[model samples]
Target: MNEDEILARIRDIFQDNFGIEPSKVTPEAHLYEDLDLDSIDAVDLAIKLQEMTGRRIKPEEFKTVRTVGDVIGAVESLLAA
Candidate 1:
C-alpha cells in the first residue's frame, strides 16, 4: 500500500483502538501527549500494527515513534520490505 493508504489505515486504527476521533489524527499529532496514549496504549498500537501488516514490529522499531506519522512511516517501511 501507498503512504496515503498507510496513513488512512493508521487513522482508522487510532479511531477504532483508542477511541480517538478521526479529526485528531494528523501527521504531527503526538501519540502520547496529543492522543493521550500511555505506554500500554502504545504497546496495543504496536500489536495492532503487527496484525495489520502481518510482520513482527520490533520493540526497538517503536522506540522512536512519537507522532501518528511515525507509525505510518514505520508500517510503510515494513510493508515495502
Candidate 2:
C-alpha cells in the first residue's frame, strides 16, 4: 500500500479506538501531545498497526513516531523492506 493508504488506515484506527475525529488527525499531529494518547493507547495502536501491516514495529520505534505521518512513513519503510 501507499503512504496515503497507510495514513487512511491509521486515521481509521485512531478514530475507531480513541474517538478522535479524522479532521483533527493531520499528518503533523502528534500522537501524545496533540491526540493525548496515553501509553496504553500507544500500545494498542502499535498492535493494531502490526496486525494491519503484518510488520512487528518495535517499542523503540514507537518512541520515534511522534506524528501520524511518522507512523505512515515507518510503515512504508517496513513494507518496502
Q: Estimate the overall C-alpha local distance difference test score of candidate 2.
A: 0.88
- Give the root-mean-square deviation of each candidate in angstroms: 0.8, 1.0
Q: Write the per-residue lDDT of candidate 1 for residues 1-81, one digit (tens) a residue.
A: 987888888889989988999889999999999999999999999999999999999899899999988998999888878
lDDT of each: 0.91, 0.88
Residue 43, model 2: lDDT of 90
Model 2: per-residue Cα lDDT over 1-81, one tens digit each: 987888888889989999999889889999999999998998999899889978898888778888898888888877887
Q: Could you estimate the TM-score for every candidate? A: 0.95, 0.92
Error of 2 at 6 (Å): 0.9
Clashing pairs in 2: none
Which one is best on TM-score? 1
Off by over 4 Å in 1: none
